[model samples]
Target chain A: MKYLLYCIFFSWGFSLFSQNKEVLYGLDETPQALLLNPGARISNSFHIGIPLISHLHFNGGSSGVSAYDIFQKSSVDINTRIINTISELDDRDFFTTTQQLEILNFGWKNKKEFYFSGGLYQEFDFVFYFPKDLAVLAWEGNANYIGKKFDLGEINTRGDLLMVYHLGATKRWNKKLTIGARAKIYSSLLSFSSTDNSGTFETRISESGNNIYEHLISNINLSLNTSGIASLNDLEGGSATNKILSRAFFSGNIGVGVDLGATYEINEKWTASASFIDLGAIFHTKDVESYAINGEYTLDGIELLFPPIGSGNSAPPYYDDLIDEIEESFSLDSIYNSYSQMRPLKAYASLKYNFGRPVGGDEGCDCLNTGENQKYNQSVGVQFFNMFRPKGPQFAATLFYYRKISDYLTFKTTYTADSYSYNNIGLGLVANIKILNFYIVANNLQWYSNFAKAKSVSLQMGLNIIIDENK
Target chain B: MKKNLYLLFLFTFIAFLFSACVKDTDFNQTDDIALTTVLELDFIFFNINSQNFTDLGINNTIVSDTTDLDFLDSEIVSENIIRADFYFRNTNSFPVSFLAQYQFLNDNNEIKYEVIVPVQAGNNIDPVITEFTEIIENNALVNFTMATKVVVNTIATSSLNNINGNLDLQSKATYYLRIEE
Candidate 1:
């Protein structure tokens, strides 16, 4: 049990990056870029992803403390290292992970120049903030500190596993502006959250009381809510897979959301785009379970009263009575309540300055070449991403240089600064072979030499078949 | 130009793959992990009025009470408790000094340990306060866990027919535990 606890603690505490895909944004050759910004221009007339192999992404890491900080070979004792690490880590430090797999994806452009795209994808996201007061209380207890209060509000965490089915359309309304919107239907498989807790536990010296030390549990309002978990047991057997597949296909607790995006051309030399995704909530009405504990209690030991002589009565069970009083004061209440959870909304915006010679030497007069179709061989841009979290919104800024090396290959490199690290470098590559398009993106290149020390890392890759209109 | 571009792309991809490498780390240090914690908790207390003793027969000089302490028998306390310090404060407002004897017994009602406190005498306007501290560790701590009950006896210095005061007792315990893998 001890090993398991430590293993889980250290594994989650190791280096990680948040769920922002900086490298995939603004790359014109890859169709996956449309997922980041629906208004993104694509020269292809139609495209089809190869089933589950279309797109895969994984990003996770902690903002503070890494495996090397404690497990690195050192002469100091491990216990001291652990203590020092705990002391240095604050409540604001958080661990987060986001994973996504594209099950089906395809898109097409109609005769009126409206680009329509849709897909179904599975995603899992989790985030847990460090509970500093609880860690200190568990490690040092209340013996050394006589009047310290452990804040229970520091315990904040949330996790969800769900499938999203989405469809979107993009069209150029005029010569200078393009706009798009995607409608989404979410099917949640499992979800749990424990947030907005408020409480404190403290021990103090009593000035005038029956006992010397007094213990107080004040203003406690803690709750945990879960959905689609209890029903998993009912889905036991070979049909469990089928049941889950069907639920993910749309039979589970469902909700609706939408993504809005736009691209604007200021002139022939500069372009700007912005997008907002996952602006929706999931209503968990089926198989929901919640528990709540609220109230305040104080104790000053068990008070014993001596019976009068020869009263013919045994001494009252003072200890048992105290236990009963405590149970009554701080009781756990099981609740069967339905609730709604908002998705983690994300916002992206970027500005690019296009220069250098246009691809294919701008020698042909083609209508499809008017927007984002390898018109410029080199460009410099800045991108900003923000995702709403339980604590607050997390933000990242990236400056990138995109180069179209040849007709069949292109690359983009980026330098990003966020809460995780200041020296994060990322790279993305897209290769075109006939009708087959392949792309890969990786982040945090500086720490690749010593990966264990890096606070965050992420990878994304995908493949698709596209047919260009000008072909 | 096309050949050079292909070669550059291939080289960049290989470099990206080869750049990720793990440095020196010793995960085996987890085997030596240990956590030491100390917890302060309220133990037992009481307030006895002198009338209870004065109501006794003219010759009676002592009164006793026994309470079951099931917490000492719990596995978590018995196994994790390495050392304990018990602090007791007694205030007496009676005319006569008293001897407070505490006897710890096992489940079968056998005495395992005993503690004696000498309480001072005082008047109603000025009560006497006496504090006692007991530390049990090593072999004594092992024997302490065997106790599941405590028998407290309050013995007056003499006949208690005219006593008119209160005896207040307050106590707490601090336990030191070392939990490791």
Candidate 2:
């Protein structure tokens, strides 16, 4: 039997993520709703968030295999379960995570139909596609993978931490249409990715006269690009959330973006709305470090030779020469290059049927068609969510019911289907007690019944002071 | 007083949500890639003219030209690959068996892997040139982190004019990478 061997020394752990706030779309009464749709329905004259308590949100989910798929106790071997899980996942499957904290938020309405708002918030987004080829190689080894071309293009992911400073204006053009636009300055603190890689890892018999087979690494250009961690701690560099918060504002890398949204009344009972948010990009130039390995090599065996340090040559440092030769073949280059990344753009659209605003026990604004306020206490609607991702565009369809329980409490429930889960149920509660207001939104409610099996989960909560004047 | 109570409740709810978040466990896996290219070591070791000389009272002795090796210096020089099967390719025109030895050295001129293997002659039936690898049981030269060079020495049994056996080294390097979140 031919004895083939190779030597490789080191690697580092890195990751990426992405985002979408589905539940908050089209829920206009809460101040946070303006983030999703700047032209969302509003009945208040002024509003402000309670310092750090204004808004806090985090979302994470995997579209492919859940923890229960491999970890749940089963009669089958754990290795077999893991293999099955890997088999079930493909390149299209991805993991997405997002975290956001609103530092400041405030809005005020004009004497007329014009309203203005502005806010500063920190956001972190990460997403990475499952490298199925790598998984197959890991579980089965190259012996069975002979002749199969495991593609390296499947290794695409992106992660970023940034601060978004935004200001927006909403104007009621007429009795039926309200439009809004938001301008934002994005200051990126951290960015990391190894996207658009190209290569093929394959194994086959030696082309020439030899008993050994060759594992060919052809046309590989795997790059790891990162920025914004110069002053971070050595041991707890990327993990300390407090460190990230400390560097949230005024990161050297900055870019500009815009959000546009509009709400229109199709008729007396039918209302439709659409919004396109995060249409921007951030340029990373400060503290940038880019690493690249772009080349090819072939290996049949590794027999490294070294000077005998002592008697009998018990250990010869092993494969130092082979490692050197492979390094020659597949060179790694480190450079400081500036790059720009477009925001993870998302689109939202909704169509709702209003049963007319319920006459509340308290005296308040009741202008139903002015396009500046809502007179409906109950409504049913469907919202379509689409987020631009590295692999492709992911979509979700949501059907929701909303009810106003007096003037102090309103509840909304939604059923959704997306790439992550088919039975995603969401709940949102908005409490408006005079000037004091609080809201909480949670998606994938059914998963709470079995957290271990959940493919996705999201939560958002906020507190604000609002003033709704009845004319 | 009602507003104060509402604020208290909101603060409590926020506290509860934060507490509930705790820590989430995420799992991920990744594998590295390596290319195994087989180089006919004969190309580097077979640059010799047929030798015809008597040495130490022995007639018709054969010797091969020395082929110098210089491993390149790049950051891809890591020691993380698993060893597997390897073989030697033989296309030489020898009619009889012989002895072949290979000596590899590091930058500081230290002999790391030394092995003497038998070579089978080419024939109409049997395989030629038995494979020669650094058959040291101790994995001494497996994790070498420095630059290296290789030299091959051989001897023929028959007093022939064209005594030659080519050397081919099949190279295979594996990369292992891990991704954690």
Candidate 3:
């Protein structure tokens, strides 16, 4: 039975490889190559084929203050006010900044057939922020010891990982007309941390007949902390961490989509292709967890009360003494937490053209030498193949232009009013060595838009390997 | 085709497992308490006929050396008593319960005589008169009489004393009344 299952899997994979023969490399327009080029497959004779591609594409400018950030800022201000009142301070300052490291695509593609291919890709990011610097001061009174200062430091961390499966195929009617399509399956894992700390000091002044006669002071430090790791598996299995972090639930949904592309021979020497890609959504089983933590302290003569911290089934009482002291002196009340989720859709498209022809010469190459080639090689005096064919090997020079129609195409949550056009203008040189069944590509890219004043440039080079048993 | 079926089965299993294990708990609801305001009063008083109270036809009458003085028949005497009653009622709300305590004060700015009745459930209860007493001293002829009628209940012609004070009457007096139900 196990062998039978293995044979079936092998046959399925074998058929996919036999389908993608013609294309040297799957196009870069779609993150899900297999989904876009479902017909793409390894050539008939080759047992295996591999293509390593690197993409350095950036879309969307810096996100403005997220609704979460706005809420966090307001919460911080509120917490600060409560802290100040409890400490009897005239002024206080607090600061926070959130950072997210997003990875959109990272994976390897395998050809299963002459016109078909499939693979998996990963996309995710680690998001965290250290909201520190809660500085407070007690006003100076008649007693020299009437004022003191302290800081409350807190850090928050959260992240998630997404894996998507893609199936694609490529079809070539002849040497000049080629088309492709692909479909994707998406899934993800998520987790986060909830922890905070606070410190406090007491300032006291002796009053004689409505006047301050002397001053006394004391200091108390308290820390409230809670930490746990949670995952989709754990969440589903009723893990303790899941309960502690119920706020962090991660689930994924399957969405169906198709990528369409067509490459045409403009002439014997030049070819052009346009593709609509990455146009799909991941129906989420549930929203991702966004969390936050807020803490405060108060001072009364000789005692302090650190804020209370609660998680799942555990509530710490180490700060109880401090909290009681402060409450009796100067009351404190405050709350803090961070929450947010990402939109599930994204869309993209590109148009490109190659300006060179096949390098090796053959009798059938005469087609390239026809009058149709004159338009691409003016130096050849309309002789076609003589001017278009490469002397050493077939190489192509290419240029492309691409843009995002709407950021909101994927999920409405991704839309922004500052939305503007993103354009990429680049040059690429491709060398095809038919005998070795491989190609080398070098490219220089630049991306810019109305959103930013400066343009970002990157240099990329990679090799494409194709194995064809028929050759 | 079997591979596709297996893939579908795998996904369904994962979904079922996830759905069954995940738990969502709701927060408890809390309610806020509301407060109401109430009114309170301190004192209420009314005094009439400081002297010769029997001038008004009553059981208590003083016979002088010459004849029985028909003080009640004298226009000036009756007019004086009427003026006092009018002064008390006009100076404040009738049933005195209708007015708040702060409304009364003489030119001297002293609250010598005052009545306080709380306004409960949109209605005011009149002040209760708790004591009434009269005494005469010296050779001066004097009499004491009083009449009280409150909400259909009447106590009239109540007399305390009648005598001659050789000099001006010097006596300490007191009166009392209470609201009926």
lDDT of each residue in A1-471, candidate 3, tens digit only? 223323322222111110111121233222223333333222222212233342221211111111111112232342333334334321111111111121222323335323555555444333222232222221111122234332333233333345555555566656676666666655543433332334443333323211111222223223221112313434555564344334322234344455556555555554555444444544433433333323333221111111121223222232344435546653332222322233222222222332333322342332332122122211111000000100111112222221111111110001001111133233222222342222121111221121122111212222334333333
Docking verdict class for candidate 3: incorrect
lDDT per residue as tens, model 2, B1-181? 6546555655564464444321132222112222332122212223122332223123444442222344322233323332323234434445665665656666666766555667676653443545443322225436333325555555667655544433223333233222111
Query: What TM-score should be assigned to candidate 3?
Result: 0.29
Question: Is 1 or 3 the stronger prediction by TM-score?
Answer: 1
Give lDDT for model 1.
0.82
In Å, candidate 3's interface RMSD is 32.7
Tens-digit lDDT string for candidate 3 (B109-140): 33323323232111123333222222212221
Candidate 1 docks at the CAPRI level of medium
> Candidate 2, TM-score vs. the true structure?
0.74
Better of 1 and 2 by TM-score: 1
> Could you report the DockQ of all the candidates, in the order they appear?
0.61, 0.10, 0.01
lDDT of 2 by residue, A106-220 (tens): 9999887677999999888888788899867755656556778899878999988889999998887887888999999998877888887999988776675333566678999
lDDT of 1 by residue, A404-446 (tens): 7665677899999987778789998887777888888888877
Worst 10 residues of 2 chain A by lDDT: A5-14
In terms of TM-score, which candidate is strongest?
1
TM-scores of the first chain across all predictions? 0.92, 0.87, 0.36
* CAPRI grade of model 2: incorrect
